[model samples]
Target: MRSVWPLVLPVCSALLSANLSAQPTETTPATSAPEMPTEAMNSCLQASIPSAAATMTVAELRQGCQLLYEQQLQSAGESELQEQQVSSEDSTGDKGERLLKRRMTLEALNRANRFMLTPHKINYFFPASYTRTPNESPYRDNDNESLSDLSKAEADFQLSIKILLREDIFGDNGHLYLGYTNHSLWQLYSDADSAPFRETNHQPELILSFTNDWEFLGFRNVLNDVILNHQSNGQGGLLSRSWNRVMLNSVFERGNFAFALNPWYRLPESAQEYPGDPDGDDNPDITDYMGKFEFNAAYQRKDDIYSVMLRNALDGDNRGALELGWSFPISSNLRGQLKYFKGYGHSLIDYNVDLEVFALGIVFTDLF
Candidate 1:
């Protein structure tokens, strides 16, 4: 029965082959017919697979109808990796730009601080003339002996340190100044035989000042200043003096000319002594209120270095003084100035100490 079954299977296979060969011998040409249009093909495929139809393009529908196939392929490939790399580089570049801007701002602030903290150098000259009678006598004697008739010259070289405090510490446009001065002078001349004859005068002074620019009467720019000064000499002939002064100054400007008026008052610290009798032995006390008014006119040039000041003082004795000064830079750290002053007064000439006096001096300054 097994042998018969095997022979039956072979006959069946032959029969099937014979039937297929006899049924379809029809021959078709290579260009049998034009292929269906892409839209028609896609419509036919979409009808067969309705879910794919909604998203299908004609070419993709004809080729393959798979969900997320292209997207998955792209994600696994270099295109997606390249996009991510580019996004990362852009983020890093943005961060770098922010950091660069921050660094530049810091650098600019540091440079400005360097300029603001820089130090300054200053120099100044202080020359004062004092005249008093040789004796307590108010009138000139027949002997023609008076300390006021005697001429003396004293000058000081001062180096100042300037610092900017609050502009509003005292008031708007106000400034504070602190200064120390070392001074030495030659007595020039003294009459030991005469009463109250002076040997020499020398001393040091410490000064503090506050100054302001204020408007007066709504039209005038007035300079209001206050000064506290302390002067001392170890010598017994002259006593220590401490006083404060308040001054009001006004300036008028016209073309290249400037005029200034200053009125000031000095408060006494203590009683001051003067020479009384001959042999330089007797001394008398002189204490009183002192006030002074000064008028000045100046011609200024563009250089601001060369100018002449015609100054007159109105006090107990009317006096006129002329001052000529010149300023120039000597070096980066040093500066120089030359000044001259001449004055005459009845009190200064007849009753007081000095008559006609001249002074010459130079100064050097440095900044750090």
Candidate 2:
């Protein structure tokens, strides 16, 4: 593959250079010539023809080009006629009408020029945010004074291959997303103070969606969604794991109100060996089952998006939890979110062990 890239690079570069070189010729027909049809152009356009007998006759080719050129001229004449009519209608109007007519003419010229010259565009955004926690939870029991002291900041970076696939194949609404995230605490605590806690996580998921605009069963926007996720914990084996999930979600929207319910299941790696115990004798291998339901509503249109969620599990025992969050878009490409979670669950832990946790964190997202 390494050797192939070097060979492939020049071929692609040459192709692009040829395409760029042809743009001027396509846009500007030589004034010195009579614009007569040529056999070379015909051959280039009809290279798929197996033989000269199958190619367009000289007379036919000439007639085709003449027809096309005449059609373009006729279209230009029609546009000029339309403009004249508009100017005549505005002649008896006020200054605003004259300005509007001038603007319309300029817009028409710009549109024509754009059709002749293809252009490319690029956009970029950056994200940064801070969070502060007021209470200590089981998941964040360190001596950190504020939430910012425990999980000081969050950052996200994302890039998307726009419209990588058409909407029809998967449905009318689908997105291809690629992203990376980083989270960390303030540099004041020792290793023991943050021991066994995850400092950073990396996630990337692809989503396919289908939706109906109208609400059914009192639901506003109804959507069917499927997601595949891969995640990694920056910690050691105890925290490092990856899983894949499939989900179906429905959303309802009416006026400024909206809500959603998401049901999902995850398949995790084989738990043949428990983390931190080489003997694998501490806990029995358990199958993991997961589900989630979420609701969201808009408010203030800025810095005040609120949402609530319920998550459940039955891997070894029954466990259920609830979460609430607020999120706001900081920029067209970035958003900041703060969320709080509380869980009552013996299922997430070993059957012999009981655990409870309350956690709060902030998330920053870069969307494309």
Candidate 3:
């Protein structure tokens, strides 16, 4: 049995070797690797693309990846800078709003003490007045030649202006101001001699004002001002008129109505060297008719304004003056005015002279 087994194994091995030798011998090339998962493929690309030189150079892939990353970083930086600029502009707008609020509050509290020369009263121009008095004309009357034949116009006109100097002086409740005002009577309609200025009165004043917050007798005190005032007509010979005074003014308000009381004491001036001279007190008895105190009252109803001024000696001598005025808006900053002045002292030249004047004009400013 052992001899038969060895002979059979030898025969099997010989047969297997003969069969393998009889078969053809050929080579088969390798195929590509199988696809990986999506995420794994991306990571593999990142890791292997830089080193896979047959597909692309590792250095070129690295440079492209760096450029892409740099572009992304630059876009992010620009977005961040734009956001910061918007934030800065918002901060500036907030600051401006706060500043505006503060300024508005200040104005509400102290409107009168604001700096700059704002107008205090109506400044206007008149084309004419009815009555014309040339009693104390600057032109002289001589025996040889009477100047009464001088060419004079019956119609007259006037102009006035006021300016301020200081505010909030000494304290927050006080103000100091200087003002110059002029009134001119022009004979515009008189064709003879081409019409000239018949009279021009110059008035200048210094005033110290204080806020008064007193309420009594149904009247609330609004302002109190002390004034050093001078008025003159710069004329020679018979037409000169001038005066100086220290005056006190008290203003009160109630609802839409306001009132002012002003009392003045005339300062003594040297008598003229000669009679009817230009440089001295032209009218010594001027106060007898002009009075010691004046009263002014004003009322406002919607867009309409009315005012009245009165002056009297209280002596029953039937002396003093009265003026009534009404104003209504004609435009945004302009108003049409109707004024009636029947009194003495309409001008320094007319201080001792009585006249009735009615005028229509535009008002650039208002008292209230």
Candidate 4:
């Protein structure tokens, strides 16, 4: 592997650029060239053709791969000219429909910069959130304020968005963006507390996504992301919880079904000098419960979407989380949502605590 990258980097560069639109070339008469063959090798050669690299040098693979990419590009463009088709994933059918819409159509090839802010994740709000167990350990720890009375029902919401910063920074495909997401839990029913915010987690991230149209088993793997993420619940001493991660995400879709793989390596933090110390890791064992990998899947039927998400630490303790959800159309942009969660990682403050929650809410959008 060490020797492989250097040897294939130049060849791979030529395949999609495989960042991977082909370089522009002069067109000749149809008789001038023999069309190169690409037998539905859907993605760029770099990702799907490592085995082939063993036998060829960059010079040998460049010409053939580029020609195949060109043909695929030509055919895809032609297909788009036929009767327009709509994707179930973009149920709202709004303009600038992103991610999935981009995946299901050739519009993704139009990588020209029409920079705009877009939703990063599913934005949702739950008005009747009921949790059986409220982790009060953090509030009881030294240096933290005490909270004697708590409510079993409250409100929860999350807002997430991203903006394109640049396109094709490296080659023809890498698009960069800045993103932020905030999740808040409110004691809406606690009149004595004046509807205080019980917990709030803020996430700010830098994202680099490599766009592609790779196909396998009727699924198109459309998005690849490399992210630098920082998440924290702003607080002092024992209530403080924060961590950083380098995460990789790969997203795939086929018809109304979509799936994603999310995995991350937590950046190391210094050990706290003492409990409640502010200048060190707020939650060093975060990975044990939040897990290093997560799998998410969703399927849509008409106006309804069924989804499930799983996270696992893959260690002896078997810590992590599971969530199941159903979202149905309530309006053009708003959808009714019902969700249940068990285990950990519901929020930064609850990352180590096991709890069960059932919530009814409205989501601004669906995951697909």
TM-scores for the candidates: 0.38, 0.41, 0.63, 0.71
Across residues 294-349, which tens digit of lDDT does each residue of candidate 3 receive?
Answer: 88876655456688889876676767899998877665445677888888887776
lDDT of 4 by residue, 256-288 (tens): 566778888887878888976777788888899
lDDT, candidate 2, 193-274, per-residue tens? 4422323333344445454556466544534455454443333333222334444555454422345555554443334354
Ranking by TM-score: 4, 3, 2, 1
Question: Best-fitting candidate, measured by TM-score?
Answer: 4
Could you tell me which residue pairs clash in candidate 4? 13-17, 15-18, 16-20, 19-173
- Please give the lDDT score at residue 88 for candidate 2: 27
Looking at model 4, report the run of 10 residues with the lowest lDDT sum: 1-10
Angstrom error at residue 138, model 2: 13
Q: Best by lDDT, which number?
A: 4
Off by over 4 Å in 1: 1-156, 161-167, 170-173, 180-183, 186-223, 229-235, 238-244, 249-260, 269-291, 295-299, 302-304, 308-316, 328-336, 344-351, 355-368
Decide which is better by lDDT, 1 or 2: 2
* C-alpha root-mean-square deviation, candidate 1: 43.1
By lDDT rank, best first, the candidates go 4, 3, 2, 1
Global fold similarity of model 4 (TM-score): 0.71
